[model samples]
Target: MDRAVQRTDHDAIASKLSAVKRGYYEDEYLELFCPRFEPRLPLINIGTWCRVRAIDQAITEFLEKNTEGKTQVISLGAGSDTRPFHLLPKHPNLVYYEIDFPTQVRKKAAIVRRHLSQKVELCDSATPVTLEGDINTSRYHLLGQDLRQLSLPDLDESVPTLIISECCLCYLAPESSHLVLEYFASRVAHLSIVLYEPIGLDDEFGRVMAENLMMRGLCLPTFQKFSTLDSQTSRLRELGLTHTISAKDMEQYYNDLPSAEQKRIHRLEFLDEVEEMNLLLRHYCVVFAGK
Candidate 1:
């Protein structure tokens, strides 16, 4: 296994921290994951803002429509994600499960024990926190399990579950990614899965993006296979899996946001790389699939 892939977690957190620092969004918990973050490029911050807010939109829509009073959110390869911190307390009926590598999980445990005790209610307050790769609380569960060898622990199959695969599963082979989706599609009935990944990799801009990542020992296997929004949607409907699927590029996502929000974000920074940013946004997309 290429452990270098796990280092992407740092990028995820740092980019988000950059966005937060620039006031593109509000994420108090993200700083706790990576305390010291040098601000990233304005372009990077804008992209991060769009990527995160787009995903947040998908998750928000899922939560609003499926207000069944009992909901479960499973984040695959959830590395230092602060969604649970913002969501768990707000939505009392929601239970969040974050699955990631053992080392990453334990890293989060150290921080959670040190800072999160006052906010999250522990599952068993009497039990001491160990060095193991698992954290249990009333509203959140951080599991130390590899997605390549995924054996889920105690999932309520009947709950209206929303699975988030944000830039994680693309590291795997296309077949492996499909298997991960199939695994969940088979288990949950009222299931919705949202994905944030790079697409349109066949283009010149996309090629440059791929080369840039490759220089850092990273590979996105779904680059060519699901390179377009249609392919991304088709992959979700593969094996007769999901019923409804919506796919949109980051540019479209930004346009879809309320005009006031777009104006507010523009005020945060001077975006001199509008053309470059649009190209980068075109190469990436956000997808939603529900069954």
Candidate 2:
């Protein structure tokens, strides 16, 4: 299987696992992955739920306040993510754009067409070629572009934009990641960027985490390069984003979540691995930057 396909497959599996545990919103489409992988560990399910919840909250807050003009959301490396479908009904005026490698985009396009043809519009057969691939669209536009090259689709700069990179940046080399950030910062006028990535790689747990990923031939090139809140904030600042805020870890993010919401998710599973969960949460961080 293609690398992009493999990554997306893993993501689908994770989503399905989290849904099975009832840790977040249900994604019935992810059930397609059930034959390939059994239920994932409770820890994996919880981690996936936390990440999804954080990003969802950020986008919700953004959409709730900025309900003017043509609101846009650009999701980078949006492999197998169904956020657009979830957001469309709430904000029918918003235009969503998802970019990823060609293989991933093609696969996702087919899936969306099969399941949501009535809701989305796939561009005509003669889709214009820019890089090595074309884009399919509806309310959501899914484009095929190499993140390393960083060529964004034609977009209205005047519109308030929300850019998301959930667990996506760590896969790129530090320079490439910076280039991606700089591309957006230079173009989008009013923008908010929400990044979810692993950090805290200076300790034993971090080392083990890094080694485990490496052993699977997965490289987190920018993990240690921006492994703390200060480094993450500084990176955004250097890239020209004005106001930046970062959570030290998921623990902080979880603490900051609403009490009712926290109780809801905690009740989803019988979590017994308190110590391990804390250590896991401490290794991941959420950073938000805007101009």
Candidate 3:
């Protein structure tokens, strides 16, 4: 909740504007979770927002191009993300699945029941069970599974599948990350994988960033392993995916975006720290691969 507020208030990320209202108890918890800094660092928030926008755009384009068939979207480590509700109205054929830790899935199911009961259906719950751990609805499904031991339910190979892993893969060891990627790649015949994760940890800023995350007891084991566009694309190809594409950082992505949209977001915030923002963006990337 606090992180969502940071994106909306400080970085001017408009997609997160509805986060507080849709997220139960998020408004009250924001006071405790909000950062103390007066002028928050916009780099992280910008990177996050850019990543979301990029992924959203990719999904939109995919849906646009493949309009005839039913599409399935699986969000790995999808924690309290309201994208399923947001997307269901426009794309009725889209089936959304969110996978996360058991506790996180339970909390999200409870919140959705309380706030969005009319729009969503809870699985096996008489009155939308909140305390329960797993969720299975017509349009949305939530599973409790550790990424290291990820075992997805049987899905149709004929239907095009989109697997999203936003800031989730970096937490796993390199071997584990490959295992998850290969698992999905081998099963899903028509599959597209979109990944957002931090890279470029060999430099000074990257080294410092790694140290900070380590201090917080969070390690990015794959950052240094697949740190560049070439490495990222190569890794996917090695895992049996084809037609891979990657953005080195948000700067490249922003440049590829519509000029009007770029102008609009640039006007939202006064950014004086260009060098720092560039360095920060350069350390993160978005990689897309399909088969």
| Per-residue lDDT over 1-291 for candidate 3, one digit per residue giving the tens place of the 0 to 100 score | 222311222222222332333221122322222233233345544555677777887778667766897999988877656667677667878888888777666666666665665653333344344446676666667787777788766666678888898777777789998998888888888888888778888889989998987765667778879887678778887877777745457678866878886676676566678788778878778888777
User: For model 2, what is the alpha-carbon lDDT of residue 27?
Assistant: 62
Error of 3 at 131 (Å): 6.4
lDDT string for model 2 (30-134, tens) is: 653343545665666777777877888789878986987578999998887777876876686788989888877777676676565445433334553223234
Report the C-alpha lDDT of model 1 over 1-291, residue by residue, as the tens digit.
Answer: 367789999998999999999999888888889989889988889889888887787789888987877899999989999888788778878889999989998998878877875665534466555555588765678898878778875788988998998888878888888888888888888889888988988878888888888999888887767888888888778745456556789888877879999899899989999888888788778889887
In TM-score terms, which candidate is top? 1
Ranking by TM-score: 1, 2, 3
Model 1 spans > 4 angstroms off: 122-131, 239-242
Better of 1 and 3 by TM-score: 1
Count steric clashes of candidate 3: 0
Local distance difference test scores for all models:
0.83, 0.75, 0.68
